[model samples]
Target: MADPKGFMRHARREWPRRPVGERVKDWDEVYVPGGVLPFVEQQAERCMDCGVPFCHEACPLGNLVPEWNDLVSRADWHAAAERLHATNNFPEFTGRLCPAPCEAGCVLAINQPAVTIKNVEAAVADRVWADGLAPPRPPERLSGKSVGVVGSGPAGLAAAQQLTRAGHTVVVYERDDRPGGLLRYGIPAFKMEKAQLERRLAQLRAEGTRFRTSTAVGRDIGAARLRARHDAVVLAVGATAWRELPVPGRALAGVVQAMEYLPPANRVCEGDLDVSPLSAAGKHVVIVGGGDTGADCLGTAVREGAASVTQVDIRVLPPAERDEAVDPWPVYPTVHRVSPAHEEAGELRFAQDPDADARLFAASALRFSGDGAGRVRAVHLGGVDARRRPVPGAERTLRADLVLLALGFEGPEVAAGGAVAELGVAVTRDGTVARDEEYATDVPGVYAAGDAGRGQSLVVWAIAEGRAVAAAVDRHLMGATSLPSPVTASTRPLRA
Candidate 1:
């Protein structure tokens, strides 16, 4: 360890977030610069090197947490980075965006605050990048097999890199103009700058992974033809079909889906768009969801100069502190979290809960009042009781110049009369694509991964599924494989 008594001497110190007012003026990451390394090393010393590390179990990718922590504690940055990348293909992405379930499973968290594992992981990745340690590792021998990856999100990219390094020719197809799917457009630059993604893409390109951007596989190329060309096909198309609010006045011009609003804002960061179509500037914005995506919208609105921003959630507000009975130690707690966006200009409203789990609950968007030009002016809410029956004298109207439906996604969109339908691949009752252990659908040689296989989830899960599916494909192609499958489709948190 760097210091025997480092943990005793120093408290857990994390990267400081930028001042809300200062960060709102630009699209840079929210954290304060250059103050993370020294503290990260100190935090690494907090690891007790448990007899059986549960942090590894907590992570779907089975990351070498304690080994890297020890390496980092010893100031062996390069070794720490290597140990980190041994399992995870994209530590940079996960370090920035993942919720850090690994920290939740830390042994030290039984009493004290968990070691800052996520922050240290990010520090190691940043150090590796600075040292130019990450280089292309192209395979020496060609397997004479080819693989096709549909989607350019985390899952697709991870699988593509692994498959390519295994001596198989890989081609990744992305429907968007750019290669990084949600990473390129959906995520705002303030969370993770696009430059990090571009650098990884450069490395992947150098490693012989070809990218075909602006190509929709099922639409542009026949699925049958694609299957014929490649020995195996991995579908990593993320769940893009957004969940929507079907309340009255949803058809209003000023109302739009959160995904539709987020992309243009990200595009603006790329200097590709002069103005986003769903700009939140100078409007009274109301975001109707309190998830991470909704938080992202809130932050974007504040930066875009929205006159006011209000985020509403139907569920009862989470406890400000962890509830031991409900959420024990070494598990992620469902406690209130103050995100950078929450620190910015926004009002978070917790809706009154309905006693019963009925269809509408105590929720009802009564109507949408609009202006003369058919633009939304305000929203009418009718409070209901346990059975969704309207409560007496609970009608309220809130001024809403722009309403964003930040209500998450459903599943991947199925194009009408496309290969998905033609092949008769099954869909679950919830509309997610059905797959077996190998991530293969009913049709042979066609596999699914990430959100396409599972529903909406964390980026860490996506990367894990990608790595697993790649191993399955490699095994199918070569009769056997050496690639690692760190996670399974059934793997989830103990509570989840």
Candidate 2:
């Protein structure tokens, strides 16, 4: 242990966010730059370093949490970065985007507040880059094998980088004009700057991973042609078939899908556009979902100067703290989470809720009313009970000039002539590509990973899948692999 009584000596101090008033005016990340470095060592010292270390198991990547915490506490950043990179491909992405289920499973969380695992992780990742500890590891010998990765999201990128480092010629194909997939377009700059992504991309390029952008595998190039060109093909296409809210006025002019709204705003930040065509400036926005994507929309809308913003969640409000009876120790619990966007919305008093939060819990949208020009004007809502049954006399209405459906995704999008269909991969009833425990598809020499095989999930899970699938592919080609396989296809989270 870094300090035997460290847990007793230190109190959890989370990373501080910039002032709400100041942060909302720009697209920079909410956290104050270099703010955690001073207190991060103390926070790292708080790791109890338990015998079993549930935090390690809770992570999808099986990250060495306690070990790295000790390394960071001792200020051995080089050793800490080495340990951090042992299992995870992109700590910067997960440190910023992951919800950190590992923290929820922290041994200290069983009693007192959890250690600042996420904050320490973010600090270590940033330090690695600042100190130039991370460098490309180009393979010393060529394996004479080639692999084609379809997608440029977290999973595809991770797989390509690992395969490249393992001496295989790897080419990643992306439908977008640029790489990074959702990291480049779906996520806003305020959450994680695109520069972080570019840095990693540069490292991958230096390590011999080639990228082919604006090339949809199933559309631009035939699946058979791709397979003929490469010895193996790995599908990392993420879940893009968004869920729909088929309510009244679904086709109204002002109503749009969350994916439709977020990308344009990101493009504006990329300087491709002066302003988002669907800008929420001076408009009342209603987001119909309560997931991370919805929170993303809430923040983007707030930054765009929305007149008012309200998020509608179908489930009831979660408890302030974890309910041990429902979710025991080491299991991810359901609790109220206040993201930076929520804080900004609360500070601005943009919500009409009694608690002044931007969310409306246990509410369902019944219909939408439109203006004479086919634009949405209002949303009709009704309260629901535990069983999702409507409550009597709880009907209400809210004015809404813009409606964003953040209702999540179904599965991988298998368009009429997409790669999935051309490759003859079978899709499961859950809408994901059918795969064995080894991530092998029905077709020989073809594999599936990430959301394409596991359904929509967190970024941590996507990276884990990417790494695991690479190992599987390597083993198939070389008859053995020294690469680490963190998780399998059947692996499930310790959730309630």
Candidate 3:
């Protein structure tokens, strides 16, 4: 356990981010490099190591939060990394990307600020690499069984790693030219550098996990062929079918999905492209969604020198603090968050909002107007009440040379001749692949996990599903297995 009085002695201090002025000029991550290391030990000390640690339950991965916090506080980096890795395959990704509901479930957060769990986790992840503590651990023996995993995202990668380490020959298939599904393309460089992903991929390769890039299972290789070649097949295909905004002028030029915009921008960073064709340079951008994806677009546009960027959310503004009565301790709450991108947007005053941020809450886009060139020129918006009914006389318009619809995703892309369609897998009414609690689909010797099975969710959840599905596969193959199953297909977050 950490210091008993540490919470009282120290207030929560977050990892310092680079100044907005400098960060917006380039795509480097917003955090000050090595900033967390200086104070992370003290932050870790704030963990109460509660009698009933709810942080574990709050996290979909069921990461051993208190144990790692205690290890980090004791300056035991190796032990902390091991503890973190026991459940989460890629703490580096989660440390940077996860929203950390674990912090909201912290006992200290009942009245005081929660410990900087994310910061400590990230610091330990960095140390694992810097200290050479994460050398490839290839299995000593081979199981002689082979498995094919579709998609190379967090879930696919996690399942591949666990199965490979379990002595099974694992091959991960990726549709993109490169391995990482969203990690390499959908996510921007500023949020998490590609270098971090590359290092992990290198380790996986050394650990006997094979990757077949640019191979779409249903198209490049038939699903039947893949299943015939492997003893078992795991589908970690992610939810990527983006939801559309069926408003006027949606077909206009410069009106695109968030996936379309983000990937090109990331390609630019990967040196595959000199510049993003959809770059927001000098354009007045209107991103119609206030989720993380919208903020990502806002930041990317700001860095691209957009004339202005406004993020519109149909939902009303969340409270600054959790309403304890409605959202009690140990349950994730709805609260306002100021991401680094929001800070940059606020500092630049790129959008006109009374709160000095880029967000425009409780507002719905009514329509989009296009110019003579068929390019979007402006977006018409209207205020909506709690019931999403339009408020009278509350309509307005904003110039929008470019509009990104970050309206989230519906489910996996089960297009005609896609993996799901070709495999004849059962799909739920929710559009996700139908699977049992063990993550097995109706088809024999085939299983589904991650976003494909769980629907659109967090990175932590994807990794958890990956680990859980791997255990199920291993057990089915060897009659019994030793892999950890942190979650079930039916498991949901402990949030209100």
Candidate 1 TM-score, true structure as reference:
0.93
User: In candidate 1, which residue ranges exceed 4 Å CA deviation?
Assistant: 1-6, 346-366, 382-395, 417-419, 422-424
List, residue by residue over 363-440, the lDDT tens digit for candidate 2. 999999998999999999999986899999988898999999999998898777877887889999999999999999
What is the C-alpha local distance difference test score of candidate 3? 0.92
Error of 1 at 230 (Å): 0.7
Please list the C-alpha lDDT of all candidates, in the order they appear: 0.83, 0.93, 0.92
- How would you encode candidate 3's per-residue C-alpha lDDT over 1-496 as one tens digit per residue? 7699999888899999998999888888899999999889999999999999989889988889999999999999989999998988899999999999999888889899998898899999999999998999899999999999999999999999999999999999898999888999988889999999999999999999999998987789998899999999998989998999998899999999999999999999989999899999999999999899999999999999999899999988889999888798889898889888889998889985545888888899999999898989999999998689999998989899999999999889998888888788999999999999999999999999999988999999999999999999999999999999999999988856
Ranking by TM-score: 2, 3, 1
Off by over 4 Å in 2: none
Looking at candidate 2, what is the lDDT of residue 424?
86
Could you tell me every candidate's TM-score relative to the true structure?
0.93, 0.99, 0.99
How would the candidate models be sorted by lDDT, starting from the highest?
Answer: 2, 3, 1
